[model samples]
Target: MTTTPAATPPGWYPAPDGSGTSWWWDGGQWVQPPQVPAAANPTTLARLALATQILLVAGGAVAATTIAVEGYGVGVASDYLNGNDTSIALFDLYDQGTLVGSIAAIVATIATAVLWAVWQFHAAKHVAGQTRRTPGWHAGSWFIPIVCWWFPYQNISDLWRAIGRVRPTWQIAWWVLWLAGSAVSQLSSRVYLAAEDLEQLRISMWLSIVGELLTLAAVPLACLIVRGITQGIVQRAATPAHTLVA
Candidate 1:
């Protein structure tokens, strides 16, 4: 006599061939075996992150160029105020240069910010789907003006935490480099503001230049970090449930 296996639990699939292969139950009847989920690929995610980084770096460089141009303008204005005719001509040259540079810089900054925001939003969406946690407020903090400059640091920290939750092996070196670069930039600005004379101004300019350079360096590092995080997420997603340790 032939016998049938007992009914499977609610919302569960029946094993194929009575061999106990788990299948999804459609609440009415048994269906085909569930398809294996796709695994995340680190290389692809890294490439995307790198693309975002490139955009960010390009934007930052443009902005910095404009800032340097503006600095030259300040020097020229100083000379003009001092009533030196030759200095006035030089200052005029700088004013024109700064105006052009400022326009370019603003354009680049907006473009880069938009790209970065898009990439971050995409990443957050993927993460939220995987973890079932809403990324609402955390993602919105980047657009809040004065608070954005520093508060975004906290947002980044939280992002890193979420990344770690998904993939414990993810590295965070890029975040550190970005933070260090920001500190240097802030210090340079403060030093420039404290300068009293032309000689001091010159010195302060050099410091500012160094700070800009550091920021430029950090841009790439930050990109790498983003790439790493993306890769980690992809890798985790790709990992098989059986292979993953609880």
Candidate 2:
């Protein structure tokens, strides 16, 4: 007696015999097999973050240099305007130099803003694996005009909340450092701008120097915070699934 061939699976193709060729399964009907794309390498996100941070740092440095030159130029200009003969000649040279410095500073500020935005975007994308939702909104909130001026503090608060969600007792030393540094920097800028006498200028300059030092300290602290957060995320992601045994 002759035996009948087994039926081919619904989604699969049949053998090339008069039997049946393997069927290509399409969405509706059998078609060619689909190719699956390879997953992205996780290290790409870290590298992107590093590159962004470097760009931001470089941009900030350029901007700082420009601001310093501008301050020096303006100081010389003020002295000349106040009737200092020596300062008059110095002002001429600084006037030209300051024009160039101002342009460079503007470019650097723009570069820093762009790099920071990219950095925040990549960070939000990468951190999504750890948190249930994206934190991009927090980054965007910083650019909202009148609201943006005060939002830095709120952003820090929200960031702390986000961190608390991931791990209890996440030290807020960096946040405090950054906030204090920023406040001091702003105060220094205002003081420098409002200085009337030579004594006031001297005091403002010292304050500005202190503020800058605080800012320098805050940068490393911020870096450390980012590193800690990333490590925490990786650890959380690497946790193995638990099996229930009877």
Candidate 3:
């Protein structure tokens, strides 16, 4: 005797390998129909997104404070050029805080990605008729080189349009700031690490300051976007799984 998988409503979902075929979900398993990957609870995704942003913001603040304590603007580099021991201590503290923050951010990001990918696939299934993009592309685009940047945005756009909104304002703002902060922050860190003189170090410090400010501005927007999307999904989930099926 075999345990029958508990039944779910019938729908068309992505092929398990994400290879672009529509499989039928037989109100149970992926027999003749396709199946969406398992997703985390909506509340869980929202909470994780919020927590990750908080950790990143706090880490960024700690980093900025360390720079401020050393002083900002011109000639500060020469001021510390004598190699004060206190400066070294400050760096040690900053390093520790940064390490913890980085770890948290990384873990949270992976979870968020997986959660969104699954949700997108499920949402696509509810669309009447054929979806513009394949369900596999919903999650797979993020991992593809170069195309990841724009493809993820495309996938997101398709997901929300299915829900009757044309992508919220908060999402656009969040993505822009996120990409900007990442670029400037990476550049600043590289400059700081490669500084060969007091002047170079000073420039790098200012860049770091700029990077922090960008990320700081981005945090709340990110939270709002996450909340909006997660809530939207939860509300949609309340209806029959394929209410919009053609």
Candidate 4:
């Protein structure tokens, strides 16, 4: 003899439309569906955002310290070139510190970038319905060509506005500092690497100093941006989908 399928039993099940509504099944037939509030847990995204900003601030400090160490090397080299007494041991120590600091800063920066991208990816997902930009764009935009500069900002600005319908003015200063600092830092590093004499080395060191300062200035702005966006997302997550701002 053939057996029949068991009944699903009387219960509420999510609607097939994915609109966050629930339909009741009364043993044998479906009942009218009602709207149910959709829930979102974005604590992980908030934590990731906070971690990324911490790394960013720490990376800035590391970069600034590295620049300072290199500046000291310039002074030591200048003294030795000018016939003043400068110990070779001291110069060697400065060189070692600069090298180590540079490596640490590079590593920290890479880690921070990765964490930041991950955070943005998840954050964008929370507002997927409200945005034209895809979640992938949130992270991938940073690695794109010329668009990297503009797209990342646009994606983030969209996220900010989509959540609370408020314009993020702080992003302006944050983006400017990030772009300028990156350009200046790259240029200064190239100049420093190409220096062939004490005068050239000193000038390059000064440029590096300026670049590091710009980067340092951007750190706080970055922290603020991350915190604001993350907080907005977390707050939105606690609200019912039906009550959310469009």
TM-scores of the candidates are: 0.55, 0.53, 0.57, 0.77
What's the candidate order when arranged by decreasing TM-score? 4, 3, 1, 2
In model 1, which runs have C-alpha deviations exceeding 4 angstroms?
1-48, 67-85, 129-133, 145-151, 165-214, 242-246
**Residue ranges of candidate 4 with Cα displaced over 4 Å:** 1-39, 81-89, 241-246
Better of 1 and 4 by TM-score: 4
Q: By summed lDDT, which 10 consecutive residues of candidate 1 come out lowest?
A: 237-246
**lDDT by residue (tens digit), candidate 1, 109-201:** 577666666666556655665333345544565677666656556555555566674322323444455556656656756775787865565
In Å, residue 110's CA in model 2 sits off its true spot by 3.0
| Whole-model lDDT per candidate | 0.58, 0.52, 0.59, 0.76
Using lDDT, give the best candidate's number: 4
Model 3 deviation from native, Cα RMSD in Å: 10.9
Q: Number of clashes in every candidate structure?
A: 7, 9, 5, 0
Which of candidates 2 and 4 is the stronger one according to TM-score?
Answer: 4
Over 122-198, each residue of candidate 4 has an lDDT whose tens digit, in order, gives 88888888776898988999988998989998888888887885766777888888898888878877887898866
- Which stretches in model 2 have alpha-carbon errors above 4 Å? 1-41, 63-71, 74-84, 126-133, 146-217, 234-246
Pick by lDDT: 1 or 3, better one: 3
Candidate 3, residue 222: lDDT: 55
Error of 2 at 224 (Å): 2.6
Model 4 lDDT, residue 189, Cα: 77
Model 2: per-residue Cα lDDT at residue 96: 78
> Measured by TM-score, how close is model 3 to the native structure?
0.57
